[model samples]
Target: MLAITRSLPLRIPTRLFSTTPISLSGHSKWSTIKHDKAKNDAEKNKIANKFSNAIAVATKLGGSDPSHNVRLATAIENAQKNNVLKKVIEQAIKRGAGIGSEKKNVDTALYEGVGPGGVSFVVESLTDNKTRTIGLVRSAFTKAGGSLSPTLYQFDRRGLIVIEKGELTFDDIFEKVIEVGAEDLEEIEGEDFIEIITDPSDTGKIADELKKEFTIKEVGISYIPKEDMLVDISDEDTKIKYDKFIAALEEISDVTDYYSNLKNEE
Candidate 1:
């Protein structure tokens, strides 16, 4: 169902790497309490693992003090929002600060892949082992009838900010975002939130300016797709495969964030 007029440049190795298979069954049965518990536990673990890495990365980038380091503050805020335990958050900070025996060198890497239905993926991961991380990523894509490839050409790197839509309408906020030098603004209907996109280098400064009036919810850089490169998956089979592909990625402990060129499903 996925059609490509031209051959996509592949980044996969000469031979496929092996990883433990991800059972799609874990996803198909969500009605029973037993299944629900398993899924909820997995989701919580994923959230905790991701925020732990994020906190560690932010602390290493700036300092552990949230007041002094905007990035660290954002990471901690997001962790707390997701209900990450206070002790886990503190431990991650200590590890990042090299103040604990658990401290280890952490590195961040980006991976590009083409998923089912020609959707391009950009995965950001923080890990101590690049070899193991790549192997898991590559296996996920392959098992989902996709492959690792050069998909960055189809996307642009940008900063994304989310803030409370408080008292202001979309027009009201658009004016403020433009005045703050953001590149674009989008209203999240029914969510009382607005998203502002900006040049990656300007994210922090713009966020600071906007924070004077708005409650900032999230601040981060993202890989956004070029208009012409967006993929739409209408076929049910391809959709199923894509969902499973995403689930597999979510189960990987090292992956922190992922981006895609898929259009919003209607």
Candidate 2:
């Protein structure tokens, strides 16, 4: 649920955003494949499934009503955007709302580790089988020349909110956010965003307030790198090795999200 933001100190090259698309260009090929793969991958569909599960969980925690249950409402909205079946979403809401005898068992787990080039990696997983998921996460890190830590203190947790450009002024957002207990706000690339640093206790309140103003892309606790790694792995062999390591980590079914301290160009 964490929104990972990478700082772009310099603008991406204009050539990178060419209007006329050409075949065989690196950007074109990668973009084409990325779009195709995202549509075809079963693992990607798991996101919708996860949202359904979240709806159930939220409904169970609060009531089944969206107006009363803010979390459940947000989860349902996200599920709809991802094209989740309406029936499934309704079933989840009912189950969560306590209309059924289904037992709810949603677990949120975090895994911290160091990957190749000593880059810090934080993985967020949602599952019922914690033992199995943790083992799989550990194995993936080990196979990728990395190891997991039982305790990771090198990262900070912060609330991240993203809004489209010109939607709201920073002052309006800031004043409303502080009332909900936000710590800081940041603006990125003409897009309005706010980073609320609240104690774990205040997260829910802050989320509810922000959702009233801007569409919530994602919401959850995140492990942010204290310092980022800027290694020069421009060579093909080294790039391939790092790419393999990342791919392996991403392949784990239980790992919903992964974050790293590595820069985009690295």
Candidate 3:
């Protein structure tokens, strides 16, 4: 799944999986929350375990060969990016492929909700405990000044590809992206991004085509904010309330990626 971050002062949470200090400029509060959670050994371990589980699921659906299975391949890439051991990735693929699980009962699910100031949120989970996961998500939304609903139509699921600005020209990438069926492209200060509006089916092909021209900084399917809400709270208050909301959401083990339309003042 490709996740897109518009120029809405929002950040994707990939930085949480790394050790580098997050930049204050262009920093997304959700990204900060992820980084903070990863700083704790216990939380980091939990996230790693979840990734392992996802790997297992992906491998099971498609054989362990990353070369042959794009989903499995991407999952392996993410696991490696987060420093998951090679053995763990391999093991997950084996398990997912049903080499070990005699009981096939696991089910994967995704949940969508609204967050603070009506920000859209999407949570992806691979669990045997669907009831618990949904309950936890619902509670988070209620506590965060939002609620759950079936109307996910407000947002569009799209393929997001991010690359360094220096790697390619905007026009060149834009032309190629459109040729490959991308919906739109945007240029930020030093990063170039492309959003491909695709049915769930065309995501992989678009991703593969773009990678041939640019180094993929991050790629995942994500719910993008249809329209953003700008809040004018004091910096201190923004930090407090926004951080609190994000912290609470990130703690939910079932919430994989959270997207919001809320923009923070730099």
In order, what lDDT does every prediction score?
0.78, 0.62, 0.61
Candidate 2 C-alpha lDDT tens digits along 1-266: 22343321111112122368566645676788897798667554555556665676667556788776566677787788777789889877765554554444645578888767666677776566899999988887788777996435656666444434356677887787678777665565334545555555566677777777676654544555554333345567656666777667555655556666665432
Please provide TM-scores, in order, for all candidate models, with all chains considered together.
0.82, 0.67, 0.69
lDDT of 3 by residue, 130-183 (tens): 898889888877886778865356567675555555566778767877898877
- lDDT pick, better of 1 and 3: 1
Clashing residue pairs for model 3: 1-220, 1-221, 2-220, 2-221, 3-220, 60-96, 60-97
Q: What lDDT does candidate 3 reach at residue 23?
A: 67
Structural RMSD, model 3: 8.7
* Model 1 lDDT tens row, 124-187: 8878789999999999999999899999998888877778999987898989899989988887
Model 1 residue 252 lDDT? 84
Off by over 4 Å in 3: 1-40, 46-63, 94-104, 163-166, 192-197, 228-239, 264-266
Better TM-score candidate (1, 2): 1
Question: CA lDDT of 228 in candidate 1?
Answer: 85
Residue 46, model 1: Cα distance from true site in angstroms: 2.3
lDDT of 2 at 100: 58
Worst 10 residues of 3 by lDDT: 1-10
Listed per candidate, the RMSD to the true structure in angstroms reads 8.6, 7.6, 8.7
Scored by TM-score, the top model is 1
Model 1, residue 156: C-alpha shift (Å): 0.7
